[model samples]
Target: MFRQTHIRLTFINSIVFIVLISILGSIIYFYTDNKLYEDVNQSLLKSVDHYQNTDGPEDSQGGKLGEGDQAPKFMGRDPRILTLIWDENGNLLAGENRGTMIFQGNEKLIRPKKYGTLEDVQVEDFSFRYVAFKTELPQVGKITVQVIRNVNSEKELLDRLLLIILIGCGVGIICAVASGYFLAGRALVPIKKSWQKQQQFVSDASHELRTPLAVIQAKTDLLFRAPQATIQEKILDVSTISKESRRLSKLVTNLLTLARSDSDQLEMKKSTFQLDELLKEILQQYEEIAMYQEKTLRLEAPEPVAFLADKERFHQLIVILLDNAIKYTKEGGDILLSCTQSHSSISLKVEDTGIGIPEKDIPKIFDRFYQSDKARTEAEGTGLGLSIAKWIIDKHHGKIKVHSIVGQGTKIEITFPKSQK
Candidate 1:
């Protein structure tokens, strides 16, 4: 899917580039063509003006003006200019630069019928831009002036300009495609990671739920089928069924909470509360469990600190950390819960002298459904407790971190801004 998206983005970029280049190229081509024609027209107009001003003699050749008139010479005159004159009777009477009219049908195209306007003329492989005007000279009858200029050089230049634009457009599109693909790949990296995590979460949840469900089904079936069993055996079967059901329910609840968090729908009811009192109550509740597990539990919060947080979720966070510590600590090992406050921030720490996590697995401890090998074997959990704790801390706008050395101890620290009274 990402590959297809990349291709599509590249295609769009290429098309946009092509259209922009095309517009720019067309503007340049038309502007250059117009300028070239304007220069040629200016040259022809000046030459024709010089001929019209000259004094000349009348001749019997159809009442036309003859050559040999002393026409004023123009400085920097174009050599390709061809001049022709015709009488009012539609007869070709005189011409200048006659040797330059080398193309066939040049003579037949210079009459009153072809007079009065500027036009393009093609005569047997020669191209000409010509203008005709009626003018009368001193001592000469009225005649029409036809001025022509060669345009092969301008045509060649336009062709070359078109080729350059085509080449430039081709190169630009190729670069656009290559760069677009590279940028699209860079952009998709984070999205790809998120998609992979979602898939893994679904697979893990399915497996975890399936385990407890299978156990509940088997235990219930045994209780129903073995009707003749002793009462104690029946009670044990019922107990197994109840435990599995509770485990299944807890897994489902955790999954739901994570789903809600993912959708940004997890709301926290925030209020100011005494931090010391809350920590003390949580520790007292865990005291019995710690004793049963043969682990020493302690709290080291002396000063009362107030904070703004979701009271219930904050309590749940502390419970998750304390429970994890108690579960991992060996018999007679110590578990410490402590809180401290400064002028601006409140810090909480849960340190345990337990089977500490390996250094490599520390980073992934808060990832959903990610359990280390030791955690899977030694603890009965769905591995989502720390994930939930992290989510709660995030909602409270706090930071949490862990430090651990294998077989020695682990320390988890969290910090939040102190509340203003």
Candidate 2:
């Protein structure tokens, strides 16, 4: 059904285009025909005048004159003549096909007053277009002369030209339909690829959740089997169950957040806030966690730098960066958070002295389900943090940049427009 629908659309569009082109070609052909007729009529009038004034009666009979005879001088070379002359009583005097000339209603030709050429008329099973000129002959006064020429050959040529144009238009339409089909397929390939990736995401997420779920189930079963088990063993089993349950909950939350973000259903409350103050508050919260990990956290900010943005989502972005720094930094490593304002924009930099990222993997760090080896092994995360951060920043009309060197450190810089407020 889809293929049939596409073909129909293509065919209709082709037909409309062909009709437009044909109309244009018809207009041009009519213009050319008018010009050709005007030229031919002018030449015929000049030839008729010369024959009436100069030629004797023998020359008019389609024969050579005698000694001292004068000849008619026609305007163009190789002229084809068809002439008719009428007397005062409406009877033919001299011409080719005289008996077949059917005059329709007292039609008279006037000089220098007509613009377009005359129409075709049938005469004795032959079609012709005639230009009539009135002249006075010295011997025979008030002679009405008509110059008529057959147009069947020219009409046939014009019909053949129109046929060629129709053939060209048909070929063009076929090419257009073929091109449209291939282009539509090429455009849909990316959509198909995204669908496949979504299927794989669901499969991987199910497997990840099952591991923690199975651990919780097995621990509860062991507790039920050993009713007289030692109190210490029972407490250990309860703790393991609680920890795995918490891990599973966190994973589910992360997955749900990603799903909502992808669907564009995550609503944020937007307001104006002091960015400097917000950074200080986030740093304070991270400092406590840094202390427990034996890591030093520091902040640098220009005084009272304000911004208009979504406060809660901005806080989440800061939290993701800080948590990542804490997880990857060795004991006693330093983490710095700073904000700087420029002429039209503000830059927020989060730099850490930690186990840095490899150059090749840096490009894909913010992609969904991506995690570096060191971060994956050392932390409990769903690999959606950076992806979420990127989305939030994009919604705020900002940009993020990262610079890192292996074994040295990594720096993430987020630039926001000052004019956003």
Candidate 3:
């Protein structure tokens, strides 16, 4: 699914970039073509203007265009300029540079019915821009003046510019496709990770819920079969049902908490509290419970430390660590809780002599529903306690570190700032 999405995103991005590049290339091509064509037109019109101002295409003595005596008068003008004239009867006249030009055209090219507007004439292999005009000179009546200029240089330049624009567009499109694909891949990384995490979370939650549900259904079947059994006679079955139901309830509650945390909806109700006193109270409550489980629980918080934090979440965090320690420790194992404070920060530690976690498993212990025991045989927890504890620590802007040696012991230390923003 993600692979398809990545390709789709890349394709969309590349298409958009291609469209923009095409528009830009077209604008450049058209603008350059217009400018160069305008320059050629201006050059052609300027030649016609000069012809008219210099005696109206006729000798000053009222002779016809291209008379033998008019040759020396235009010999020094632009060599690319070609001047030709025609009479009302369609007779052709030539100037000095007319024969020098290599263009050959029929009557329609020379005898335009109008003037002042430039037009293109392609004669064999040569390109020319020309303008024709007719006026009654002093002696020649209705004589037409044709001014033509060679524009091969401008044509070559426009063709070269078009080629360059096409090449640039091709290169730009390739780069757009490559970069679009690369950036789209980068963008999907986080989304892919989140999707996988969500799938794992749902699978683990379903597995956790299924066990208790199956037990509850079997116990319910037993109760229904013995409808006349006394409450005392069926206490053991009832107790089993109750135990599984409580476990199911706890699992649901943990799932809900984790879901809220994932969506960032878990609000922190923070307040300044005495850290040492809270630890003392928690230790006292768990003291007898640890003794019943045949383990020793102790606390070493000698000073009062006021910390700004979410008090309820802080309590839950400590309880989670303490419960995990008691569950894993064997009979006569020692569990220690300590709180130390400085002016700027407060530190808390939970140490236990338990069946220690492997070093390879320590980093992943806080992952939801992850058990250190590969076979998952211990079965003492829903495996979400440390995950929730990690969330609570993060919410309070705290740092936690785990130190454990296999077969020896495990210790978890946490440090938090005195004030939160």
Candidate 4:
């Protein structure tokens, strides 16, 4: 699915690039072609203007000549510009022409209707641009002067330029395809990771919900089979049902907490709270439970600091930390909670002499649904506590640090602002 989406994105990007490049290439080609043709026309105009303005004639023909004769002047100029003079009787008179005899057949070129108008004529493989006008000369009867130029050089240059433009566009399109594909893949990386995470979350949630549901169904089935039994006789089954129901409720609540967090719906509801007292109150409740599990619990709050934050969120934060410590610690292990106030901030640390997490797993412990080997095998948790705790810390503009050594212990320290501005 992601691959298909990436390909589509790349295709769209490449198409846009190709269209823009083609338009730009066309503009360049047409603009240059127009300029080149305009330049050739300017040269032809200058040659025709110079011929018409000649004062008296050189009269180099001498003698009386034909009745329709004309005296010609020899003024050699650019070899590309060709000149021709003709009489009214359609006879080729005297003119200047230097190169390329490809322009032939003077019959159609001597027409009076073609006077003063620039025109193009294709002769074999050559292109010619010429202008014709009849001028009354003192030394020669009314004769038409034809100014022509060969534009083969311009044509060749335009052809080369067009080839270059086409090649550049081709190379640009290739680059667009490669760059578009690479950028599309880069853009999808985060989305792909988010998708994988969402899949894993759903699978884990289903597995967690199924356990309590299966247990509840089994216990209810046994109760149905023993319909004749008294309430006292079915007390154990009822207790089991109650316990599983509570566990399922807790699981659902945890899932909802995570859902709210994911959707940015969890409200901080911050207020001023006594940091030390909240932890102390929480520890008092957990001390007895720790004793029951053959573990020792202790607290060390050096100063009573007033912290301004979401009191309930801080409460949940402490609960998650202590619960994580209790679940991961072995029997007879010790759990410690310490809250201290420095001049700048409030610090809270939870240390446990538990089956500690491996060094490699510490970094990923806060990822939703991520569990270390010890937690998966030896503890009962949905593996979302640390993730929620991290969220709470981030919301309160605080930082959390975790340090754990395998088979030894783990320590978690959190720093919070004394008062947010």
Candidate 5:
């Protein structure tokens, strides 16, 4: 599918490039053709004027002749310019043209109309520009002077230019296709990764949701088919049902929170609050659970350190960190929570002497649905807690860092900006 996408993108890019080059090439071709023709026309007009004046009769003192005078001493005509003259009686007179002999038997060529300016004409083997005009002489009747200029040079140039344009267009389209394919691949790398991630997320979410659903179904089935259960048995069954239901609820809530965050709908209610108090309050809630597990839970803070941030998200952040620390720490192990204030930021640390994560897995722990090898085999979690924690801290314009050694301990430090107000 991605290969097809790349091909389609390259094809579209080639078409656009080809169209633009064709337009530009046509404009250049026509403009150059016109300029070449204009140069030939100007040369023809100059030759006609030279013949009309220089070849005429001289004055009494042997000076130049004026207009409308017969030439006693005729000047030679330009070799590139062929002149032909004919009297009103349809007989050739005054000038002979070797080039015009190609149209000797053609009546239209012998008795052509006055076209006033140079016009394009074609012969059997050559192309020419001809102009016919009638000028009266001193003693002779009206005679037509037809000037012909060869245009084979311009034709050859235009042919070469056409070849160049075709070659350039072909080469340009080839390069466009090659470069477009490369660029499309570069552009699709990120999109392909995003698509793979989305697929993985859906599959993982389905697997996680299916576990609780299966438990709920099995427990309810067993309860409905029970053989005369006592009150306490019924109560135990109800407790099991409630536990699974709560687990399912938590899973769904996490999924929904992530979804809202993806759609940019997680509204934050920002306010100034005492970080120390909030941490203490959250730690108090987890202390009993830690004690039940026979782990030492501790909180270290100087005084009431005020900060500006979303209160509910801040609470969630501390809860996630503390809960993870408690879950991973063994019996009789220690979990420490600390908060400190610097000149420009507030820092929080959650350290636990638990089964520390492997060095290679530390970087990927924050990824959604990512579970380290040890966590995957030994622990029970939705694998979304740290992801949520990271997202919350990122939204608060903060940073989180993790340091761990396998089988030793793990320390997570989060830093947030202080309120200027």
Candidate 6:
């Protein structure tokens, strides 16, 4: 589809450019031709004017003569000129003898009023452009003068210019086609990257969700094997199965949310809400879970901080961060939540005294299904908590970062624009 569209657009553009160039070239050609004709006409008129203004009769050696009987002189002496003069009786008066021979059988050449200017005519074997005009003598009879020249050179130049235009346009079209292909390919690179990421996301989601499902299935089968067992053992097995099932369900839900976010199908309702209040609410809900695991959850915000955002998604974002902090922190470790607002943006920080991530793993910790401890498969997460948190922040037009030191702690800082609601 993209290829076809690009080609169609390029073709249309090329046609438009070709038409414009052709129009401009034609305008230039005709203008140049008109100018050439005007210059030639002015030169011919100047020659005629000089001939008409000559004063006296012929010299002793035929040096100069009056306009009535004298032939027009070629000041530039160009060989192309073919001049002629005739009397009223169809007899030759002066000028080139070739004109006399040509007009000997044509009586139209002697008529004063019939003589035309700059007319196309054929004499002998050559085509010529001829101009004829008459001037009356004081005492002698009327005489006609005609000037003729060839037009083959001008036609040759025009033909060469048209050939050049054709060749140049062909080459320009070829280059445009090549460039269009390359530009379209470059523009689609981002789409190709997004597609590859989506494929990886699908594969990772399947692998991560399958593990908890398999655990739940195995635990359920063990419960069936011991139908006659004690109540305590059966209760323990059922509880384990239920926990794994819940874990798998949460993973699937997060996966769906991430997919919706990626496809831009998730709708968010924007409103002004208190960020500190939202964080406090999430902390209170997760406090029971933290206490059950023998961990301490704390909120460090000294005052209320307000922000513009989707209240529900903002709650989910805080829940994800607090859950992660509790999961990674050891029993009796500290988990802190805090928020600060500035003129342009606001920042929320979640710090935990946990088994901090390694330097290399920290960079990819937010990637789907990526965990720092490869050998610690006993952990109960599908490894999508940070990924989901990151997606939520991105959808809100915010940024998140992590600072970690192995065996020391990890701190996650998220910043949201004040106007991004």
Instruction: Judging by TM-score against the true structure, name the best candidate.
Output: 3
lDDT string, candidate 6, 1-421, tens digits: 5567666766666566667766777787788777656656665555555556664223223454453335533332234554555556655554544534555555353323445466665544544565677766555557666555655565566668777767776776676566656665665677667777877888888788788888888888897898898868688778888887887788889888888877789988888988888887788888898889988888887877878788988888888888778878888899989898888989899999988888898889888877778564245676787887887788789988889998878999988899974
Which candidate number would show the highest lDDT if scored against the true structure?
Answer: 3
Evaluated at residue 242, the lDDT of candidate 4 is: 95
Model 5, 387: alpha-carbon shift in Å?
Answer: 2.3
TM-score of each prediction: 0.69, 0.69, 0.73, 0.71, 0.73, 0.65
Flag regions of model 4 displaced more than 4 Å. 20-24, 27-94, 99-124, 127-151, 171-192, 263-281, 284-288, 291-311, 338-348, 374-378, 393-400, 415-421
Better structure of 4 and 5 per lDDT: 4
**How does each model score on lDDT?**
0.79, 0.71, 0.81, 0.80, 0.79, 0.71
Model 3's alpha-carbon lDDT is 0.81
List where candidate 2 sits over 4 angstroms from the true fold.
1-161, 227-232, 374-376
RMSD of each: 6.3, 8.0, 5.1, 5.6, 5.5, 7.5
Over 1-21, each residue of candidate 2 has an lDDT whose tens digit, in order, gives: 446655665666656666776
Tens-digit per-residue lDDT, 208-293, candidate 1:
99999999899878877988888686888788888999999999999999999999898888898998999999999999988998
Residue pairs in collision within model 6? none
Q: Cα lDDT for residue 7, model 2?
A: 63
Model 6 global lDDT (CA atoms, 0 to 1)? 0.71
Clashing pairs in 4: none
Q: Model 3: per-residue lDDT, tens digit, 1-421?
A: 8889999999998998899999998998899879888866776677677776776554434554445454312221455566666778866654444454343345555455567778877665567777877766665567666777777787788889889988998999999899889989999999988989999989999999999999989988999999999989999999999999999999999999999998999999989989889999899899999989889999998888888888899899999999998888878999999999888888999999988889899999999999888453364788899999999999888999999987778999999987798
- List the lowest-lDDT window of 10 residues for candidate 2: 69-78
- Candidate 5 lDDT over 21-61, as tens digits, reads 89989999999999999867776777667767754423323
